[model samples]
Target: MPAILDDFPVLTPVTDEDLALAVQAVRVHAPEDWPHGTLCRSERVPYPCRLARWGGVTLAAAGLTDDQVSALVGTDA
Candidate 1:
């Protein structure tokens, strides 16, 4: 089971573009060779990042609070 589980409200929902961009951003910016805290797992790089940014935006669009959205996936979104 995945330890990361956060419920995202259907308010804004996730668009195909958003998902795609998110994946790409994570892939490109966060190289596997980077250290654990080297922007891999942190809010230093604009939180969830482009993909994560979409998530936070969607959640916010759903009427969630900033903290709530950030807390949803149990990750810093």
Candidate 2:
């Protein structure tokens, strides 16, 4: 039987387009100096910012590993 994770598409080796979309999503949704430390509050964040954060979370949940996510953000995820 196939594993549940297998049911979801895996973005193996990630791609430039993926990174672009993530960045764009964050830029369009999130506010300047967004995603601050734990001190940050969600309710204060913009709707689009929340959506962008959700999008990244969704991608990670789908199958994107920390490394892959890091590549997208140009950091060590």
Candidate 3:
């Protein structure tokens, strides 16, 4: 098994469009999440799954390690 994904869920990476949207999601929501209203995912995690999904994509775009990304913002799965 690839060591980077050893303990993570079996999820596909976020797409380019998803990543762009995720950047928007993070910009519009992070540090504060009211913009997303009740549907916002931050009610639980510090950076909700949706936001994290986008962040993951951004990290991937930047060519970071999966473990590094997970360690930084965690996975969407």
Candidate 4:
């Protein structure tokens, strides 16, 4: 069981294009202060919208920590 789990194949391999797009999504979807509460700056949905979450997950899967993601988010600003 352990071997099977360890050897499990990745269904979708991460590519440079994917990473770039994820980074863009993360940066563009950054949260903003709304009169009611936080929301996504790009799509204007709630903060940490689907695209942003997907980017964060992709970055994490690519070995970036939460701090790293936060730093990445701040890099453009």
Candidate 5:
């Protein structure tokens, strides 16, 4: 018996192309007032726009360094 259970893997391998597609989906589905709109007005960032957030999580889960995700998302520092 272990002190902590591994449970299940929530993160899976993802490719750069996948991330790109997610980003595109976000952009395509973003509302006119997105990025600044209230959550009430929109239900969880709408359809594809939610992909951006999902992409970030997936990128991180795929073992990508923060810098890598940022670079892919054009937020490199």
Candidate 6:
């Protein structure tokens, strides 16, 4: 299992288009308050839904810090 983990979620080299798409995803999928719990604003799923997570990963791959990504998307989620 540990060995398999080493190769999981392969990350390709970040590209300008990838970074732009990631930022857009994060912006569109920002979290929203809910009675049950925080949820994804666009998809209405749990906070930090798959698209948000993907955006974060892509941003990180593009050498962006958490703060930078948050600022780029104008949200902390």
TM-score per candidate = 0.36, 0.37, 0.32, 0.75, 0.41, 0.80
Q: Is candidate 2 or candidate 5 better by TM-score?
A: 5
Q: Candidate 4: how many backbone clashes?
A: 0
Q: Backbone clash tally for model 2?
A: 0
Local accuracy by lDDT, each model: 0.46, 0.52, 0.50, 0.77, 0.51, 0.83
Where model 4 places Cα greater than 4 Å from the true spot, the runs are 1-12, 75-77
lDDT of 1: 0.46
Clashing pairs in 6: none
- Please write out the lDDT profile of model 6 over residues 1-77, one tens digit for every residue: 77753422416798888889899988999889999999999999888887788888888988999889978988664
TM-score comparison, 2 vs 3, better candidate = 2
Weakest ten-residue segment in model 3 by summed lDDT = 5-14
TM match of model 3 to true structure: 0.32
Which of the numbered candidates is closest to the native, going by highest TM-score?
Answer: 6
Best by lDDT: 6
Residues 1-77, candidate 2, lDDT per residue (tens digit)? 55742323436454666656655554445434445533212344544344466547555645777677656655544
Scored against the true structure, residue 63 in model 4 reaches a CA lDDT of: 78
Superposed on all Cα atoms, the candidates' RMSDs to the truth, in angstroms, are 12.1, 9.0, 10.4, 8.1, 8.4, 4.5
Error of 5 at 49 (Å): 5.1
Better of 4 and 5 by TM-score: 4
Model 5 per-residue lDDT tens digits across residues 1-77: 55343332234456667666655543443434457553322345444334445655665666777777556545535
Our model 5 lands, by Cα RMSD against the true structure, at 8.4
Task: Tell me the spans in candidate 2 whose CA falls farther than 4 Å from its real position.
Answer: 1-20, 27-48
lDDT of 3 by residue, 1-77 (tens): 57853333313465666555545554444443455443335434445455555554565765667676444443342
Question: In candidate 3, which residue pairs get closer than 3 Å at backbone N, Cα or C atoms, i.e. clash?
Answer: none
For candidate 4, the TM-score is 0.75
Q: Candidate 6, which ten residues in sequence have the lowest lDDT sum?
A: 2-11
